[model samples]
Target: MHITSGSALYHYTRSGTSVKKLYEASWVRYCAVNRSGDKIFVTNSMSELLTLSKDGTILSIFTDRQLQSPTAVHVTETGHVLVCWKNTIIQVDIEGNKNVTSLAIPNVDNPLSMCNLGKCIIVGSSNILVLKIE
Candidate 1:
């Protein structure tokens, strides 16, 4: 998968065939595909989270007021969508749909990116933060 800033998201097969393309006018900062390969979560410069299908269809969009300057996104192995913005990380529980929680990471300043590694999550900014999942 590839994302072009202020443009679109492209998905290519292993053989280099372009399978899907999602066009967006906003500046796309980051994206994460779920473990099942059926859902794609995207973060834009406008602090919005866009949920799309594997075929690039818009499924849902989260534009909560608290999502300020979302810089990174990741999908956990258990299917939760993690969005990093400002000094906080918001976990969108996909199973419950309504269980959204925010976690404040100590000493994390202006987090720029994040990814899941086994049971832990690594967030990067000027410094790095590793959080173990319980």
Candidate 2:
């Protein structure tokens, strides 16, 4: 799976001829696929969390007025979705309840990308920021 600007998610088959797409948002900063490959969590530079089925079907959109600049997203092994804002991480449960985490990558100002690596979150930006989580 790969994402292009202008808010598009593309899934390509082996030979690269077959492509599946989800083109519903204006800007998709990052996306994470669930372990079951049944759901996808997407985010932009703003505060909307979009959920989609693997077939590109729109499932749900979650947003919180308190969130600011939600620049990146990651999905954990336990089916929880984590979104990284400027200085916080918003954790969303399957029921859509939002929990904010005061997690950060030290001195980095831009937590623009992220992924789950076992027990830690590997932050993405111009510099590498790795933070361990309980």
Candidate 3:
């Protein structure tokens, strides 16, 4: 599934309809699916992270001002949710949706993208930085 420009999550299929609308939320910028692909996570511009069931049901919502411009999110094997803002990385509890901790990256500017690389997080914007979460 991918986020449309109108902030809608869409899953394209080869059936007659071609595309299926999964969920609609405001300002959605990034999305991540767990390794099992059962739970999907999406982050928006309003400093909110939304967890959705595979069938498009809202499971939980996490909001915080510190989640400013949450550019990316990933779920770890150990049931941890990782989110990246402009210059900070936040670790959250997957089940409780609670903020566990936050780490700041020095000299990071407008972080617009992120990805998981096994043991590290790849944050990219003006440059690429690899961060190991311990």
Candidate 4:
């Protein structure tokens, strides 16, 4: 899957053929596909988390106040969705619930991207912060 600057997500075939447009929003910053590959977690400029189905259907939207200016999102191997909100990493469950744990980076002022490396998560900004997750 790929995202267009115009706030649209597309699914393409392995051979590089465009399958279909998956979803569109006012301003989509980052997205992560769930463990089962059936749902997508998206963070938009509105500081909201959107959960969409594979075929472009909106499933849920989380408008938690803590989602302030989310910059990146990642789906962990264990089925948790991690979102980069300011200097904290918020973990959301697969059901789109926002009442989970959040890890605050010690020195990082802002977090822009993140990747799941098995037992750890690497958050990148001006500097990199790695957190070990069990």
TM-score of candidate 1 relative to the true fold: 0.87
Steric overlap count per candidate: 0, 0, 0, 0
Tens digits of per-residue lDDT, candidate 4, 55-131, equal 87889988776789888888888888888877888888787766488878877766878888889998899998888
TM-score of candidate 4 relative to the true fold? 0.91
Misplaced by over 4 Å in model 3 are 13-19, 77-79
lDDT of 2 by residue, 1-134 (tens): 65655577777776765476764566766788887888887765557777778887778878886467677777887777887777667788753446544454466665777777788878776777787877
Tell me the TM-score of model 3: 0.84
Candidate 3 lDDT, 1-134, residue by residue in tens: 45555477776654535366777767766777776777888876678888888776888889876787787687776667888887888887775277888888877766777677677877888888888866
Model 1: pairs clashing at backbone N, Cα or C within 3 Å: none
The lDDT, on a scale of 0 to 1, for candidate 4 is 0.81
lDDT of each: 0.78, 0.71, 0.75, 0.81
Clashing residue pairs, candidate 2?
Answer: none
- Selected candidate, larger TM-score, 2 vs 4: 4
- Against the true structure, candidate 2 has what lDDT? 0.71
- Regions of model 2 farther than 4 Å from truth: 95-97, 100-105
lDDT of 1 by residue, 1-134 (tens): 65545567788777878776775755776788888888888876667788888787878888777688787888888888988777888888673143288898888877888887898999999999999997
TM-score of each: 0.87, 0.79, 0.84, 0.91
